[model samples]
Target: MFEALARFAVRFRWLIVVAWVAGVAGAVVGLPSLSSVIQTNNAQFLSASAPSRQAADLAAPFQGASPAATAIIVASRTDGPLTAADDAAFSRVLLAAATITDVTSVRDQGTSADGQAHRALIVTVPNGPGNAPNARLVTAVRDTFAAASAPAGLTFHLTGPLAQTADADTASTQTGDNIRKFTLLFVIVLLFVVYRSLLAPLVTLIPPVLALLLAGPVIGQAGQAGLPVSPAIQQLLVVLLLGAGTDYGLFLVFRMREEIRRGRQPREALIAAMGRVGESITFSAITVIAALACLAAASFGLYRGLGPGLAIALAVMLLAALTLLPALLAIAGRALFWPTRPAAGQQSIGMWGRIAAGAIRRPIPVLVAGVLLFGGLTAGLNGFTTSGFTSSSPATASDSAAGSAVVAIHFPSPTSNGEILLFRFADPVWHNPDALQQAHQRLLTAAPVSALTGPLNPNGTTITAADITRLYASLGPTGSLPPTPPAGITPSLYQTYRATAQFISPDGRTARFDAIPAAGPAGSRAAIDAIPTLRTTVADIATAVAATDSGVAGVDATAYDIYTTSTNDLARLIPIVLLVIAILLAVLLRSLIAPIYLIVTVGLSYLAALGFASIVFVHHGHSDGLNFIIPILLFIFAMALGEDYNILLMARVREEAHRYPLHEALTRAVARTGGTITAAGLILAGTFTVLAIAGNNTQAHQLGYTVAFAVVLDTFFVRTLLVPASAVLLGRYNWWPSTLSRTRTTDTPPTSPQHGPPSPPHARRARL
Candidate 1:
């Protein structure tokens, strides 16, 4: 099959080149403008039934009149009560901001508990579903706010989703620039070392660069088509395409060169190399695609959005490797290795070869050592803890150390619980005389409430006239409270409330309960589990509210709904991915035994990677835990890449076994392909390590370190030592009941034979 492919590629090399050119041109012409949004859509991030989503739905109507951005009011006074002059100046600043095109309203002003610190203004911007807060508007607001001269001894601080998103975007852009610059340098230097030829390394990098170019436009179109792409997907695509794409390209070229060294013509050598390596490449690509596709099953939109893009990128890379790469090699001919000639009578026994030799000499020792090393890394899993959105933001340095510090000092808790609970009043009952009063009573009495407001509506039928109206009004035009709600109701009521209930329907048919976990940061773990407890409380409140003849229906049960749903989806998807990988390996290897061993080795490598990541980021790296999404993402990438090495080593062993005994074949295969596999592994590892330079944020750092370490271990220990050792141990059984054994037996040479070429008499005598 590979020979035929190689022949076709050589015959139609120009056609392939032309097709690529046309494809690139078409993609460029058809590319859509890239636009992205950074909003915390609870349903998108969490689960459909999450309290946050429920609350959002209930609050929807009220929110329509409110600003999308949170307003942070800072008031620092040097002395007595704030003067009228201060109030007048602040009001002018806020009112001026309200006139901006995107600004919805600005309000909330009062005095703080200390009297010396007075409450200032909060400006709200319109944020509607599907409509992101305008960056220009946000910047305008910030600039306007900053320019406002506060009366002497007053300072202001701004912190909200809008500000955070802007900061994160800026940080990500800078990080991307750094990554692009550093990665270019890294790839160039590393490729040179591996190929030992500047031209060869440059040639090797082409496929990946082309793949990335193609992937970008395609992903842009996907995004426009409503395929929920997260901005982070772009970064992942770049890293994977470069790393995995280069690895594949190098593997094929190296094998082709090896074949050429054995005296075959360039065309025949390319054919033989493809024939031997093509299936492995296809299988490896399938593994990666399948793993990424599994993410589609994730409950979070982020994962679901990323899955298709990654799968498409991997598939394109695979096709390029099989078709375009072969064509390129065929065209280059003997000069592909220019400036360096194939050494005469030279037997290359590189570092990997020596390592394999040692492993072969002491298989058990090698296996034991490898297992123990991996086991120790896995132990770090104990310290792992999950973090929130702030932790994921690239709002600070390469590692986001400064951002993390800021969060710790000023916002030691989850920035906002992002949890919501919804209530819907049965239609007919909403008009009932007692409906509004009863609902307010239930909300006030709810177990989670630290404070309560509303039942302020006199009519009690219309949503705007209900108790929620007073609450919204108190939050002011910016949706934030004054230091204290006018005397009778302290402004702290909104902030202290476990759940802020609001009516959404104009007819008073629906209401929302927004809740913050009372347990705080130290309580996240317990809170994550106790969602059921919160749900029960919510249910009880709903029942009480409904009894008023208002027919209030529970829209959301608890914050736990989001967490549990995602956790469940992750649990289900992981096994499905593993099963798919195993089946693919089985079919590719055409042997159940080989597939089982391969899958086990890959699984162990994944666990080891996760464990090691946990140690560095959680224990030594001092992070709360690896990013919540890291395990799944790592599993997919690691397993896919691991399969690449498995295919390379196993294919070589199978081919060599056709001539030599199983033990000797294993040794020969390891020696011959070890260098290529090692080089490929190191290149892939180095590409991931670039993330370690991401600074502050541990997500990139942990992921980069884990993958890089896993690849190294896989190449050196698992592929080089364990695989060859096991293959040697398996002996003839490795071939099973196949014709491979039959062909070997039938092709055996006679005991005695005359040489084709004449040798010196003395040399012939010495050999005899």
Candidate 2:
């Protein structure tokens, strides 16, 4: 099948090339921009049934109090408490801030309880989703604050959800360009080092570039078809295509060059090379696609789109590898390696050959040592901690992070992020003082609650029913009270009742409270961990209040949901992914045993990769933990990619074993495919390393580093040593239940270098 396809590709090379170009161009022109359709909000990526989503639904009708965009301005005294003069300056800054365009309303949240340290201003503005503040508004707010006069000790910082969204978006955008440039440079440099030719690297680079150009349209179309593509996944498409495309291209091109060196004509070499290596490339692509497609079963919306999105990317890469890459090699001919013609018999299998030979000689030791090494690496799993969807400290040098630092130091709340708990009773309770006090106490004492604000009088003070009634009556139906207080009502009591109105529904049955965490940043482990306790306490409190419904909904809750869903997705999808790979391997190898062991080796490689990443990023780089998304992504990329090399080596082993004894076949297959697999691994690893360094987002960096490290481990250790050794030990059983295992060796001896090409029947029969 591959021989026929290769012939068609080379026979009408120009037509094949032209068709690919036209298809790619048409797709590029027809598809929409991926960014336009990408979802940046974490909430949008949650499953409809996620607890956070449920809470959001319950609170949606009552969410108008918090503006879509807000700029939180925190001011502090550098030396001491704010003096009278500094307070005057703060007032002027607040007034100036209000006049800025798009500024809806500005409120002074008041001074810190200590009175010696901090004061804050909250400014609301019209903005887009994801809390992305309007740039113009941000600039205006900052400028207004800057112009204000203040005492020597006073300092101001600007940070909030709005500023964070803007900074994060900028970092991701800038990082995308950096990743592209770095990947291209790495590919060129590595290919030059490997092939030792100027033309070869350039030729090898075309398929990946073509694949990248083709991906935009494919992703756009998928998005149009209702697939939810996140900005993160959109960025990932390019990296995967470049990395995987280069791998397949390397496999085919190196094999073609080897055939040419063996005295075949360029066209014959191309066809023969494709015929030989094509199965590996095809099977590897299928393995990757299968693993990714399993993500479709993910409960999280983020992962559901990811599985199919990556699968589509791998498919395009496979097509380019088979068709366009062959056409390019056919056209380039021997000149593809120009300026560096090689001497005869100079083929270098290098250390891989040595490793394969050692494995064949001492299979048990090699197998045992490999298992021990893998087990050692898996030990790092104990240190693994889920960070959920928490945002890290801003990666970019932005004002938002700077402002958040000052806020954390000076504000009453320990962190800048806040959580809101919502409750609704079967009975109206907002007017009932006892019910309000009971609910407030429940939230106040909840675990991780450092501070709590309730729906009744904000200050801890006493007020009778008669005082409240007079205040309400005086306030009238419009929520506006007479300027003069009623004779019996205190002014403070009237002001408190007015401020509490926003927390209650007009019907007075539902109420909301804001809670601040005891410690940690918004998305940090501490804050996310506090959510369950908060929810349980709130639920019990709601029952005590005879409320019909209650839930915690805020930044912490969202982060918690993201973690829970990600964990659930991992649990459910991993078994399915392994099963899919096993099934695919079984069908391809025609041996149940080979598939079983191959998957085991891949699994070990995956754990080792994660352990290695943890060592580097956690122990050395001093990260809190591996990013939440990295584990599953590592399993998917490492195992599937490890299988890529496994399929290439084992498929060749299966082919050669038919003619040669098991041990000889294993050694020869290792020697023959070693250089190409190594080259592919180097290129793919280099690309991911480039991404690790250039990826601007925190998670991207983590993913890049993790995958790059794992690919190298899988390539150098698992594929090179463990797989070949185990296969040698397994012998003919490697092809159990298949004709290849049962078939007898032919009477003809193995072909020599002087024997020329074997008969087509022999080649075909060997592959079967």
Candidate 3:
């Protein structure tokens, strides 16, 4: 099968190249916009099973009037402490903003205690087209306020839920673009360095570029086919295709060059090279695809979408590597090695042969050294903390950070990082105001709450519980209260009475309030840790009040659920990926023993990489902790892509072992393939290094660096040293239960009592 494909590619090189180019161009021109698919994917990051999704469903109706929809604008006074002029400007702006659609309630939260800042709140209807709020609406509000004239010496900032989402999205998009651009540039330079010929690098790069162009459209179409696709898949595709495709190119090209030096012409050499190495590349791509497919079992919609989307990308790359890359190599031929052309003769087994000889001769020392090195790095796991995944807030460099600072200044209440708490009952609580007050009092004492805001504490201070009942009587029946204040009631008091309609449902069966966690912002490590305890207290309050249903919603609750789901996914998905890849290894190598140890080496490599990342990004670096997704991503890429080298190296070893004794075969195999693995590892590592440098965001940097470091470790250490040494120690059992294992004996084997005979005279002559 491999020889057939190679022959067709060599015979029809021009046609293959043109067809691939046209196919990629078609995908680029005709497919759905990448951004549209990303937006759709972003809206579904949480599955329907998540508590946040359920909470959003339960409180959908109350969302319109909820203060949780509110935005805050802080007008900082530069000339002096804020005065009446700032207040007047604040009121004028507040009224103008109120006219904006979905702006439910606009209030001057008023001057800060320090008297240096003034704040006004603008509340919009929280519900948008999908799961998230309308971030575009925040842009509109922000632009309106920025366009409006403010008091002299006042600088203003617009910030709230949707504003935050908008800012974060902007920063992420910019950084993602930078990563793609830099990765492309870096890969070109790296390939040029690796090949030394100008045209050679370009020829090598065409396959991966074509694969990348085609992947986006395939993923978009997959989304249309009802496959879950993550918005983040596009960012990751750049890393995988460029890295893996180039590795495949180097695999075939290096061997082709060697064959050319061994007296074969360009076309014949490439065909021969493909015949030898094609199976390795095929199995490598299949291993990565299988590993990624395991993510389909994840409970988090984020991971579930990521699995098949990435798998689709690898599949496209596999096709290009197998077909287009072979054609390019066939055409480029000996001229592809222009600056350092090889003359026709047999190639030498030089540097790697000597190194491999030492490993086979002194396997114990090499194996022990590899183990100690990896073990030392893995000890960095001591600092690993599963605090949570990344947050939607922009980085410190973004405008959102400026807005948060303003919030910290003027809106310095304990509830600054709070959640929206809601309770539903079969009966209305307005008539039974005491039950409402009782629930509130219990939350303050029993829950993690530092403060609570609801109908009973409308102005952030207590209002008598009995007055709530009396006030409802004066305001008339449910949903019938006059918009205007009646006689004997103050206008401010009337607004409070009207607000009760918002805090408690107009139908009067449900109530919503705000509760500030004692720990801090929902994304903060401490706050994330405290959510389980808070939920238990909420349940206690639910049972005591006899509420039919209740929930804690907003950022904190959603983050807690996401973290829990990711934790479970890591636990479940890791074993599934390991089993699937182990099976693939077993079938490819025809050895159960080889599969077990191969998987162990890969696991060790992954864990060491993950721990090293924690040391870089968490323990010593400025980041609070490793992003929860980074470990899972690091593990997948390390284990899957790392196996590419494993397969290539081991397959060569097995082939050589068929023709020679075990120790000599291992040594020769390493010498022949070592240069290829080194070049491939360097190119793959370069792409990820560009990712690390250009990622710009904390989580992106962590992921990029971790994977790059892992590739380097596997290239210089595990693949070069650990795997070969362990293989020598395992001996013939490496191909257990297969004909190779039954018939192929080691050079020095006599452990079995029945196997102690000398060879016949003809057999001895055949060995010579």
- Pick by lDDT: which candidate is best? 3
TM-score against native, each model: 0.78, 0.84, 0.87
Better of 1 and 2 by lDDT: 2
For model 2 the TM-score comes to 0.84
- Model 3 quality (TM-score): 0.87
Report the lDDT tens digits of candidate 1 across residue range 1-768.
Answer: 877888899999989978976897688678752234333333345544555454544555444333235344434445565566666556656666777775554544333323443333344554432223445655666566567777776544444444554555556556756765676678889888877765677767777887777876777677767666654565667678888888888788887777676667778888988988888788888888988888888777767877877898888888888888888888887777777765323455455656666666677787788678878877777756654333244344422233234333332122223234445566533345365566556655665543333323211122323434455445433234333345566434433221122223344455543344443332255545545655667666667667321211121222245445656766888888878888887676666677667777777788888888777677876665566667777777778788888887777777656555455556566777788887888878887788667533566677678788888878877898787666655555555555554444323322322212223446645633
How many Å off is the CA of 99 in candidate 3?
9.5
Error of 2 at 76 (Å): 10
On the 0 to 100 scale, the lDDT of residue 176 in model 2 is: 74
* lDDT, ranked from best to worst: 3, 2, 1
- Evaluate residue 592 in candidate 3 and report its C-alpha lDDT on the 0 to 100 scale: 87
Candidate 3, residues 29-87, lDDT tens digits: the string is 88753443543212246777776667666665455433235567767875677766666
